[model samples]
Target: MKKIVLLLFFLAVIAQTAFAQVKKPTLMVIPADAWCMNNDYMTTYSAQGITMNVPDYKLALQNDIDLLNVITKIGELMAERGFPLKDLSSTIRSLEQSSAENEMLMSATSGASLAETPYEKLMSRAKADILIELVWKINTVGPKRSVTYTLRGLDAYTNKQIAAATGTGAPSISAETPVLLEEAVLSNMDNFASQLQMYFDDLQTNGREVSVEILTFDNGSGVNLESEFDGEMLTDIIDTWMYNHTVEHRYSVSDATENRMLLEQVRIPLFRENGMPMDTRNFVNNLRRDLRKAPYNIECKLLTKGLGKAVLVLGEK
Candidate 1:
């Protein structure tokens, strides 16, 4: 009878402990750009004297089995910590579908270019709050090997490196590549994941950071940034709009010129009122709408360089 009572008491404690731990900030893991190049998962493009090499996750998915094994093991570790893993392939397929739909309907109707780079599409569809990047190399020395690794945790909304860890694994048998990689990750991942979570918690209380820029065309027209609207210069108007729209009026003007205005450290709510994630693209669209109305009534083009930097072109694209 005492044994039965003790077992029930321990089970209740276990249940309470499990229920007390809640996870936040969904995560997606992918190989680092440099790591892919070293492993031959690369694609190159050249326009002038410059050559650009980008990671080919698709090719890596198909060809790099050993790297995939390490990635899978790392994901398993994330899962053990109660962090949900977003699948990259599934995100890609969803993005492809949404891109096609946007092109077919919205682009055709509005006559706007719906062409998005693969990276942007993935960013839109992944639904991940943080991106965990893994870069690693395995070196074989005679019968044993070691793995040197770097892991970076980036905020999905801000593209900031909130957490990073690097280390070299202890030597082990040459064939123990996966095991060595696991140990290397395990040694630092708990702290890395905690840092990622802590960043989101901080962002929740204090808003996410974003940068905005205003520029005009270099055409012969005299459209200067100093031009005034309703007695306020274009730069001042932009500042007022930012102050009115941003969270708690938290933003700073780094530089202003007759042709350009740079606004940095703009704080935005983690989620929009509609419960959607707030990103630079969406936030700038609202700014565009406002700028197209009222005294300013400026017709401008909004371009986002990834998830955090947004540029508003005053005169032309």
Candidate 2:
């Protein structure tokens, strides 16, 4: 009888170990080259009729460098998260030439061709369950400069689009125009990569079908506003609350009373059921009240007044 009981306990331990060994799906990230150009296909129809002639090679090379940086960063981030990076060097090497061409031509331009040369293309043929496409564009709008980035993930086998995200950022207009543009691109690159990783992680855990939003308000008075409670916030709240009723993620307080600050939006997945508590409302409320009382010490302040308002305004189906 004693031997039988010991055998049963050993079997149970082996079963638990097997269950814990279940591997998560691997995500494949395909970093594509950027297509930056002074003249897009639309340049063909301008009143000047594509008078600006710039070499497409420079733009393509710049984009390639930028994309490589993003890929390296993402690889580092994923390795830190314990996810395997599928070998992509062969696929990247196969992409000898990628170009973008304007398919449409305006008739009004007549013989004055406002057409842009087909930009190089960056294609990825990786065989993996998940894939990511990162595209960026640099633009100089008069005195202001900006960069637009697009991030998309698709199922490698099915070719179905899983997630898509877009972000744009600009630099302050100043005498150091070139420096500001570089800074803007670098900053936007980090933001784009971070968001892409978050979305990819969600898709890997949950089904590919999920939606998330992140909203930030920067009032000059240093007050930051978030709409719905997020995992990052909840994690901090939990760690702090579990130890002591305190807040952990605090934004700067603003002195401007005129509401000069505006709100920005970000999207995220709903849930993953990965150790996070299902009920977060009470936790949020308690955290908020604690912050109000001890605002100076807490790292974050939960804006109870604005949470409901944000839900009412930005609720999704």
Off by over 4 Å in 1: 1-23, 46-50, 94-121, 124-127, 156-159, 170-176, 217-224, 315-317
Candidate 2's displacement at residue 17, Å, is: 11
Per-residue lDDT of candidate 2, residues 1-317 (tens digit): 99999999999999999855744435555533333333231222222344543233333334455444555555565555555666455444453332222223233324333232321121123334456655556567777666666666664433556666665666455624334324444544455445545655554344232111122234333333322143334234333443342112222222212222222121112232374321222334444455445332333322212111111111111
Which candidate comes out best when scored by TM-score? 1
Cα error, residue 141 of model 1, in Å, equals 4.3
TM-scores for every candidate against the unseen true structure: 0.78, 0.31
lDDT of all the models against the reference?
0.79, 0.40
Any runs in candidate 2 off by more than 4 Å, and if so which?
1-24, 31-63, 77-82, 90-126, 142-144, 172-317
Q: Candidate 1: which pairs clash?
A: none
Per-residue lDDT of candidate 1, residues 59-126 (tens digit): 78778787678778888988888788998756666766676666664332246655455566677677
TM-score of 1: 0.78
